[model samples]
Target: MGFLIGQTYRKMVGILAARFKEYDITTEQFSVLCRLAEQDGISQKEIAARTVKDQPTTARILDCLIRKGLVHKEMSAADRRSFLVYLTPLGRERLDVLLPLEKATLAEIFAGLDAEELARFRETHLQLHRQLDALHQQQEA
Candidate 1:
């Protein structure tokens, strides 16, 4: 069981790590940028919820992105306590470059699988994720 779990996690991490390295960004940071790109002007708290990261960890990652001029944070006009985050021009450009590589990486990973296998794999993956989410909710409860 342990071996199976380790292999599954390692393969997922290895692929992401290699692609992240190619783009000179860590996996966590890329996730933040992708989230911001999709949901621009979202609050940091919302980003943390979406990313399943703690607030402090998300804050630190955002700080690095801000320093690199990839993201800008502005005080939310409607909410004095919250700040809205959006990608800077540089961030959008960088993400544009990285997205192609991400697509290529995903293609490479799925290349050898036949259509039926691919469908089955996705179905199983989604099922597993649902089960995991249920477990997480149970634990939280």
Candidate 2:
């Protein structure tokens, strides 16, 4: 089951990467961008938490985005220690381009599935995610 799910995720990522070649962004980077798009001005630590990424890895990704001029980080006014991350205009423009690629990829990936099957698949996926989350929390405890 793990192999099957991993292969499916890998293939989907491969397809999206190929489709968005001009962006020079990996799926991980795109994920960070999408998270920031939904919750802009969030702290790097918060981004890490929300993305289920470690602080160092998230920081490294944010550094690359900063270098690319796609994201900006500012010292948090409320927390003297933390920094807030937000997407720049360039990042938003890139998202505008990437969103269509994502939608088209989903359309292609689910081309044959009927609505009922798709709904069931989505529910099952969510259940799997929740179970995984619980497992992780147990390990942490």
Candidate 3:
């Protein structure tokens, strides 16, 4: 099951990456952008947490987004040492364009699954995530 899950994840990333090629964005970058779109002006640490990405990885992804003019980092007034990330106009426009494509891609991939099956799949995945989160917390403790 782990192997299957890994393969599915790889395939999903590959498909999304290919689709995003024209936009010059990676799957990881798109994820950060989506998180920012959901809530702009968030600290890098918060973005990392929301995206489930490590600090270094999130910083690198943010660097790329900044270079692409999709995002910009500003010093947090509340925390001088930290930076808040916000999506630029270009980033918002790109996300607007990609949102439909993302939905269409999911629809295509899950086309064979009926609504009930899709719900069940989603529920199972949510349960798995919760279990993993608990295990991670236990390890941390």
Candidate 4:
């Protein structure tokens, strides 16, 4: 089951990467962009947490996005050491274009599953996530 899940994750990333190729963005970058779109001017730490990426990995992704002129960072007034991240206009425009592509890709991928099945699948995943979170907390404790 873990193997199948890993395989499915890789395949989904590949599909999304192919779709995002024209925009010169990776699946990881798109994920970060989506988060920024939802809440702009957020600290990198917040973005990292929301995206489930480590600070170093998130910094690297932000570097790529910054290079592409899709994202910019400003030093936070509250914490000069940390920076607040925001999407450039270009980034927002790109996201607008990519959002539909993402939705369409998901729709295509889940086409076989009816509404009820999809709901069940989502619930199952949520339950798994909760279980994992509990395990993680236990480990921390």
Candidate 5:
């Protein structure tokens, strides 16, 4: 089951990555963009937390996005050492273009499942995620 789950996750990401190829971004990068779209001007640490990525991984993604002119970083007023990340105007415009494409891609991917089945699938994944999160927290403690 774990293997199948991992396989399916990769397949899904692959499909999305292909769709995003012309935009010169990966699904991981898009995830960061989506996070910034929801809330801008947040610290890199906060972005990493919201995106469920480690600091270094998040920084690397930010670096790529920064290079692509999709996002920008500025020194935080409260902390000179830390930087706040924001979506540039180009970033927002790109995100706007991609949002509907993303929705369409997801709809096509889930076309086989009915609404109820999709709900159950989501619920099950949420349960598993919560369980894993709790286990991780326990390990950390």
Candidate 6:
């Protein structure tokens, strides 16, 4: 089951990465952009948590985006220690172009699946993650 899940993930990411090449972004970077598009002006720590990545990894990604002029960070007014991340106008424009491509690429990945099956799949995955999280907490305790 783990192998199947991992393989499916690899396949999906591979497809998305190929589709995103022209936009000069990886699937991981694109995912970060998507998260920010949903809600911007978040701290690096928040982005790391939301993206399920380590702080260093998230910082690296954000740094690359900043170099590309896609995203920028400012000292948070509420928190003097951390910076809030935001999408630049270029980032929004890039998203406008890539969003449709992302949708189309994902549609290809789920080609034959109906809405009901997709919903069930989503729920099952969520349940699995919850169970795993509980197990991890138990081990830590």
TM-score per prediction, in order, is 0.87, 0.95, 0.98, 0.97, 0.96, 0.94
Ranking by TM-score: 3, 4, 5, 2, 6, 1
Q: lDDT score of model 6?
A: 0.92
- Count steric clashes of candidate 5: 0
- Tens-digit lDDT string for candidate 4 (13-106): 8998999999999999999999999999999889999999999999999999999999999999999898899999999999999999999999
Query: What is the TM-score of candidate 5?
Result: 0.96
User: Model 3 off-target regions past 4 Å?
Assistant: none
- Cα lDDT tens digits for candidate 1, 1-141: 658968976886689778778667877888899999888999999999999899999999999999989999999999999999999999999899887877888888789999999999899879887998999999999
Specify the poorest-scoring 10-residue window by lDDT in model 5.
9-18
Q: Return the top candidate by TM-score.
A: 3
CA lDDT for candidate 2: 0.93
Clashing pairs in 6: none
lDDT of 1 at 71: 96
Q: Over 4 Å off in model 1, which ranges?
A: 1-6
Q: Write the per-residue lDDT of candidate 6 for residues 1-141, one digit (tens) a residue.
A: 999999999998888888899889988888789889999999989899889899999989999999999999999998899899999999999999999998998888887899999999889999999999999899999
Candidate 3 — worst ten consecutive residues by lDDT sum? 97-106
Better of 5 and 6 by lDDT: 5
Candidate 2 displacement at residue 134 in angstroms: 1.5
How does residue 30 of candidate 2 score in lDDT? Answer: 91
Q: Please rank every candidate by lDDT, starting with the best.
A: 4, 5, 3, 2, 6, 1
- Tens-place lDDT per residue, model 5, 1-141, is 999999998999889899999999889899999999999999989999998999999999999999999999999999999999999999999999899989999999999999999999999999999999999999999
RMSD of each: 2.0, 1.0, 0.6, 0.7, 0.9, 1.2
Candidate 1: C-alpha RMSD to true structure equals: 2.0
Q: Report the C-alpha lDDT of model 2 over 51-129, residue by residue, as the tens digit.
A: 8899999999999999989999999999999899999999999999998889989999999999999999999999988
Q: Candidate 2: minimum summed lDDT over ten consecutive residues — where?
A: 19-28
lDDT by candidate, in order shown:
0.89, 0.93, 0.93, 0.96, 0.95, 0.92
